[model samples]
Every structure is written in structure tokens, then in C-alpha cells.
Target: MQTQKSFEATTQGILYLVPTPIGNLEDMTFRAIRLLKEADRIAAEDTRNTQKLLNHFEIQTSQISFHEHNSKERTPFLVEKLLSGETIAQVSDAGMPSISDPGVDLVKAAIEAGITVVPLPGANAALPALIASGISPQPFYFHGFLPRKKKDLNAELETLNKRQETIIFYESPHRLKALLDQIEKVMGPERKIVLARELTKRYEEFIRGTISEVSEWAQNEQIRGEFCVILEGNANPVSENETAEWQNWTIKEHVEQVMDTEEMSSKQAIKEVSQRRSQPKRDIYAAYHEI
Candidate 1:
């Protein structure tokens, strides 16, 4: 039972989760610059990469290396600094710290030590790519990266295909083609998908089409930049096996089953049942009401 009053005064120093621009340097927020300047120390994923950002903004604050390779060794040291009333600002090479980055471990340690952790929202890649993907913006599942192994990847895709919400995934340029091919195999070639790359940069591009079209495009074109893949949700999620069982049931019984299983209204269930059974809506409605 922990409550965080962000603005309240506390004896312990605060931990700030800062977000850096993904590509465009101008996307850096004024508050982020100020925090970097004011924080006692900056914990960066890569000090060299982050140094360029600091130099561009003319921020001379010192930075300590804090990335996946060293997070285990650094988390305790950062927590100790926070315990000693030294403000710590954590930043990744780009975008938000913990999203596909290693800032989460430090955050957990800070929280356990009773230090206030404040997150500053500035820039991120997932939301930007999602809104522009021409897919349903609401009810989206942000999957940062998929499993690399073939068996694990197939298993993951099988589960992800069942979701009704639009799915988002991050992929490197080198593996993009193989991933699309695998998706085509599991989800079929007709599924609509969008691929956005070089986000926020000058060469930012989006390829929107069916999985087959996109996969074909990837085969010949020079692939570059990290990709944000937006896959359309399953529109007709009811499996063929479910439809097979519908043949044995009465129209009214089918409507009731769809209503209960899909959690849809009677009107919606009737419409769905009519489409699945290849019958008129009026017929389904009449059968449902015993009219």
C-alpha cells in the first residue's frame, strides 16, 4: 500500500524517469532539459550517446552509465545515491527509459527504498507510429519486441492473433522480412498491416497493405531503420470449428450462443448470426423472437 504524492516534500531525493527524443532533437522538452540540468546526476544507458544530447542542449551535468549490461551492478549504487538525498535522472539512448530499455530495474529498487519516482513524458515511438498506422487507435496492445527464436515466435503469434485489439510490435531492419513472412504463414496473407520506419527522422516512411504486399515489398527494397509493425485485429474471430457446431443448432439457439460468447447485444448477435449462417437478418430476428 504505497501512495506517491509527486509534488510533496520528502527527506529522500527523487528519481526522475526522463524521456529523450527518438530521432528529432527538437522534440526535447523544456522541462526535460531543466531536469537534466538540475538533477544531481544523470544515469544514461550509454554515456557517449547521451553526451551528444547533453552537448547539443549545452547541459554540462555529469552522467553515469546505466544500461542492460550494467543495470544489475548500478541499481544499488543509484538507490544509495537517492537514499543520500541525491537526485537521480535516468534516461535511455532514445525514447522513454523503460519501454524496451533497462530503466525498470532501477525504478523498482528506488520504489522499494521509499524514494519518489517521477516520470516526465516527452517523446516515444510506439504512440507516434500507432496513431499514424491507419488502424484502430483505441484498444491497442503495445508489444515492444517479439521472440527471436522460430518456435517461440510462432507460439507468440498464435496467441497474439486471437486478440481483438490492434497489435503493435517493434522489429529491427535486418529481421523485418523474415518476421513478415512468418506472420503471413500464421495469420494469412490477407491480413492488413502497416510498417513504419525511421520514425521522426527525415526518411520516415510507412508501408501499408496486406501482409503479402508488404512482404513482397520488403523482399526487393533496401530495408533500413527500426520498424514499428501495426497489425489489424481479427475481424471474424469465431473459428471454423465454432461455425461447424452452429449447423447443428437452431437459429435461435445460435443467436443465444453468439450473444453469450461474444458479449454482444441481441441485435448485434442477430446481425452476426445472420452473416455467419448466410441468412437474412429478418429471418434470424423472427426466429429469435419466435415471431
Candidate 2:
């Protein structure tokens, strides 16, 4: 139940979310530079890293460290400063603040405190990678990073495999091979994906192909830099056999088939049967076991 008139005057100071360059420095916008220069203080994910950017542009504004570990602690302090009429700019190491970064919590707190929060768009890796990815750009899903654990990663992929929009994920250099392997295993080999790394830098590279091909290539390649994976989404999600599966099945017949085919216990089979038919497992179990 809140309305934000961004340009309206307020007693509280403003919070400007400034986006820094992902790699190349020239991508820094004039407004971004001016905001950073004029802001009373800059809240940076890594002050040491952000200092280099400030030094390069000759903008001498001081920065306070605000990262994942410290954001919760720093948020209250920053909010108080805003209430005291001190304008602040929040930035990440690269790209936009709050996009897979810790600045999100601060922005939420700022809004709740009735501070005017403004976002200045600048360079980000996903859009740059997406447009060049040759995949469908509209209706895209930005999943910042996939799960690191194997079981969770597989479960996530199961849901992602059914999405109809282009999918995006950020992966570190070391995890690229494992991520691709999971993609090939869960999403299938034919799904188109693009891997972009070192974007906007001298060695910026794009790897585009089927998941299997890219996975194979990544296996032996000398991997470096963070990667942005753009995957083509599902269009033909319903398998012909799956479409016909629900039509010919009695409750008991479905449960028996899943138990026999999947080699599962009655309880496990009941769950699968329920998911496929969109029925409650408790109800399916009652019918199958006649209880």
C-alpha cells in the first residue's frame, strides 16, 4: 500500500543504485559517474575493488563496505544516514547492485523507511549475452545461479526443463563443467545453450551449441572467467506418450505400472502416480490399496 513518486521532494535523503561496468570501464555512463561523484557516500560490495573504479575516474567519494556478510549489519546504519538527509549510492563489484548481490535487502529496507530509491541502468552481462546468444530474447528467465549441491541441482533442472522462456544462469569458472554435465543429463542433449564468458573484455568468448556438445567442449577446455549460460526453453513439453498416459489409466492400473516400471515401493509409486495425474497421493493410495 505504497506509492513512489521518484522525483517528488521528501524530507529523507535519496538512495541511488548505480551500476558499474562488468569489465570494460568505458561502459560507465555519464549519469552514473555524476551520481557517484555527487552522492554523500557510496555503499560498495567490496570497497577495495570499487576504489579502483573511483580512482580511475578521479571521483574521490568515500565508500563503506557492504557485502553479503555485512549487509544486514550495515543496512540500519545506512538507513539512519538517509533519514539524516545524506544521499547514498550503492554499487556492486561489477554490474548492477542487488542483481544476485546483497544490495537487495538494503533497497527493501530503504523503501520501507520511505526513502526515495532510484536505479540507474548500466552494463550487465546477461542482456549482453542474451542478445548475442541467438536464442529467443523475449520471455527470458534470469536464474542467477544454479544449486551447487547435486540433488538440489537436479530438482531445479526438473522444473527448469519445462519452462517456455529462455533461461539464464551464472556459473563460476570451476563449476562450468559440472553444470553443463547436469544440464545434459537432466534437460537432455538437444537443448540449445550458449556459454558466454569474459564478456566485454579482451578475451570475451561465446560457446553456442547443443548441451551435449558444449558439455563435451567444456570438459577438456582451459576454463577461465565467470560464465553466463543462456538456454533455449521448452516448446514441445508434452510427450505424445505422456499426453495419452492419463487417458487410459484406472487408479489401480496407474499405480501398478509405476511400481513395476520404476522398481519402487508402493509408497514411492503412489507419489509418482499422483504427480502425473494431478491427483492427491493419499486419494490414489486409498483407491490402489482399496482402504
Candidate 3:
């Protein structure tokens, strides 16, 4: 009887941040299972999705539907349970919660409310794609997902193109080809890119080559699954012939000349010159005294 009391007291409720498998079910960690089973309540992004996983593991812990649509209303109630000493676990449909998902807001609220929040270590696609991408993982930037608008996407890619460390972007299967084409147009066709698709799954594939090559390949194949595009940093700048007629002009004039010759818009011309010169857009604009 004393031991049972001790166990109950020790089980004071806490919020557990559980990580689900991104692709393969085998990737789920044992600790995650133990915590999920032990928790008094589980908040799942999608009850149906979590039910499938729970059924496989035979975890019968009570679960509540918590997602973007209901997060605003649900978080307060979950926090109340934690405060009342009811241990709760939160899991996304896949991967870690709040990472390109809805779990982050809940975690933030829990922290602000002085509740204990625990994160379980497990599968993540970003790190794997970066490490296997054959690019410097350190000092790299992970742009969760690109903007859908063409101009917005190009602008974002332009900024990343100037970064010294590798850049990783999450892309959907349907948009992979279009994204690659934009990368080629805004950054350059010769830029190196690594496409990691269906990671850890049976059909996992890594297509590494110049942006143009990968773009062409994706165009011809039946693309499926989520994609992580890892791009190599810009190459070193090259010195152009200073005496050339186009070399000595102001940055704006040079940009205008390229726009005229290539029949590209001002934005496209700016992007091209910046990539070729291995300089940031702001610096290029400053050099031409446009800014």
C-alpha cells in the first residue's frame, strides 16, 4: 500500500513532448513508447493518425484531439490538467511536434505557465538530410518551407543563395519540380543541390547533382513523398575584366545592361549578377550606388 502511494505521488503530471516517426514506424524510440503508455493523457495532432500508431504499439492511454484548428481552445485545458498533477503527452502526426507543426504553441504556453515540459529525442528529417547532403551542416540554415508565391519564393531563395553555409528547404512532392525550376532560374542552373526523398522508407532516394540536372530528372520521373532540398553554398567570387565596357559601370547600369541583353526583369537580373559575383543583393545594389 505504501509503495502504491509512492508511485502515485511520483507520477505528478508533466507535459511530455513526444516525437513520432517521420516515415518508418521502426524509427520510434522505446522511451517514447514507455512515456506515451505511462502518461495520464495524450494530445494528438490527429486522433485518427495517432490511433493507427497507438493500435500498432498496443498503447491504450486515453487520447484527446489537439491540432491547429483547436489548439487555441485546447491548450488552456491541457495546461490545467498538468497543473492538477495529470501527466500528459503530446505527439504530432509525424516527427517532433511544433516543428513545422502545431505543438510549439502549446509548449510555449506550458513554459510560460511554469509547467514542466519534457522533449523526447527521436527522428527528424532536417538533420538527416543535412548530414547526408555532402554539405557543411554546421552554420547552416533550415528554411522550414518556401513561400508559395513565385516572387516571394524567389526573394527568399535569393537571400539564401548568398549565405555561406548550406541551406535546407522542405518541399512537398507536388512542388518539387517547380521549386527546382525556380532555384535554377533565380540562383543558377550550375549550383549544386541534393534532393533527399522518402527518407528512411523503402523507396528512399538521394539525387545529387547540379540544380539543372536534378530538375530535368524530376521532370521525367514520377516524384512522390516529401522532399528536403539541400543546396551547396555559393562559389567564390571571380574577378571580371576591369577594362571591359560593362565592368566599370555602376551596379545599376550593369544590372540594366544585363536586363536589356538577357531580356530578364530587373529582379531576375539582380539575382543573376548577385549569384555570378558571389555577393549579397544589398552589397551589389550598394556597389552600383542604387541603395
Candidate 4:
């Protein structure tokens, strides 16, 4: 266990995690700008994108590319520079580094090497979207980007389907409609969902409605910019105690209960039961048919 006395003066070079504006350039903080200029070098997710921000702010800081493709190769080098007392600042193309972008490995390496990591709060898409979403912001889960593959995405949604805390996810414009459709299918059509896009920019917009309604909207809108989805938590959800009761029922009996309540066919009932019990559908099917 490591305790970070962040403000304490250390002889070792510090690693500053600086956040850039998600949209508006004015959102860049003074401290972030200072750190970028003061650091020996900047490690950016995309050097070209970060260079534009640097150009706009008139902060002429040299940047080295350190994204997912090269993080493994570059982290050790950055850590060595830090250990040698050369301060480095890391930034993503937008928002905070190591968030959905890159820099986590470097930060971890820096910490292990006794290098101080000082994070400067600046701009992010999630917090603004959350505050404006009219959903419960206090106990929200930041799931970031979901899996790209449909099957993996579905499996993830299954785990998150019953969470009581408001959930936020980032999605690209091209995939937004597909993702909303998937959410509607997995989480149900009537669940409340808000899509905040182009956050903090002039074209910033919010699409708020039930999952089905938003899914419809997603299909029609000329989708542009990144998307932040703020979804309401499950209401009147099945509790663990309620699900534990299913443990007492035989597999066939459990299928019968779900079939009667949801008016689903034997096949459909088995699928739902499989998800709830975290069991393979084939296993549930075999046990049910065995009875």
C-alpha cells in the first residue's frame, strides 16, 4: 500500500496528469497550461491532436506520442526520465489522460518508482453531462466505453442491467444508434436514458427520453461528435433476497415461474433464467428439460 503526500516536495521528478478541454478551448485551466509549459516533455495520446491544443493556447511544449499502440514501449522510458528528475506531463487528445485515453501505465510506473503524480483537474465530458442529466449524480458509475463487439457488449450489459446507481458511457457517433438499440434490447425499452453530445461546444445537445424513444431518435439524427449516455438506475429491481428464492426452486420450476409471470415461451424463459442465475443457457436448458 502506498500513501501519496502529493503536495510534499520530493527531489524526484513529478508526473503531472494534465486535462485538456473536452470541447471549448477556454475550458483549459491556468494550472494545466503552466504544467504543460513547465514539464520537461509532454506525453500525449496523439501528438498531432495535442499539438493543435498547444498551438491554440500558445504553449509551445514538445510532445511524444504515447497511445495504446506504444504505451508498453514508452512507459519504461518515461519512468526512467522521471526517476532521473526530469518532470513529464501527460495529456490525452481531449479531457484527462489515462481516462479512456492513455497514460495509466506511465502513472503506475511513476508511482512504483517513487515519482509523484500530481493531477490537475480541468475539463471532462462525464461530469458536465451528469449534472445536466437530471439523473442521480451522487452515486453514478462511470463505465467509460463499452465493448465494441456486439456479443461482448451484450454480456457486459447483462452484468450492469441491475445496477442501482446511474451509469454513464461514452460512444462514438457512428456506433451510437447501434449501442442505443442494444441497450434498449438488454435493459428494456422503457428505461430512462439521456444522450449528451458535443459537450461544452456550441453544437452541444442533449437527447433525453426512454431507451426506445432515444433509440428511435438516434436512428434519425445526423449524428456528429462524441456521445455521453446518462442512464437512470434500475427501479424496483429484483433484490438478491428475491433471486435467492430461485435457488430453492428446481430448474424446471424456475423456468415455469418466469414463463408464467413474463408470458414467455419455454425457450425465452430459459434464456432470462440463464442471465439471472449467471449460468450457461445450455446448462439451464439441460436441467430444465431433465426435470
Q: What lDDT does candidate 1 reach at residue 108?
A: 92
Count clashes in each candidate, considering only residues at least 3 apart in sequence or on different chains.
Answer: 0, 0, 3, 0
Residue 269 in candidate 2, Cα distance off native in Å: 29
What global local distance difference test value does model 2 have?
Answer: 0.89
**lDDT for each residue of candidate 3 in 1-291, tens digit (9 for 90 to 100):** 111221233434678899999889999999999999999999999999999999999999999999999999999999888888899999999998888888988888877776777788898889999999887788888778999999999898777766777888899999988998888876766667999989989988899987778989999999888998899876433234532665677678878877898898877777667667544565676765555
- What local distance difference test score does each model get? 0.90, 0.89, 0.82, 0.87
**Which digits, one per residue and each the tens of the lDDT, describe model 2 over residues 1-291?**
999999999888999999999999999999999999999999999999999999999999989999999888999999999999999999999998988887999999999998999999899999999999999999999999889899999999888877889999999999899998888777666668999999999999999997778989998899999999999987645455775975688889888887898798998878666655545456888999899
TM-score, prediction 4: 0.82
Candidate 1: stretches off by over 4 Å: 239-291
**Among these predicted structures, which one has the highest lDDT?**
1
Query: What's the candidate order when arranged by decreasing TM-score?
Result: 1, 2, 4, 3
Q: Model 2: clashing residue pairs?
A: none
Put down candidate 1 lDDT per residue, 1-291, tens digits, no spaces.
999999999988999999999999999999999999999999999999999999999998999999999999999999999999999899999999999998999999998989999999989888999999999988999998999999999999878877789999999999999999888777766667999999999999999998789999999998999999999886676576976888899999999998999899999988777655645567889999999
Writing each residue's lDDT as its tens digit, candidate 4 over 47-120 gives 89889999987888788999999999999998888888888999998998888988889888888887899999
TM-score comparison, 1 vs 4, better candidate: 1
Q: Is candidate 1 or candidate 4 better by lDDT?
A: 1
Model 4 ranges off by over 4 Å: 239-291
Better TM-score candidate (2, 3):
2
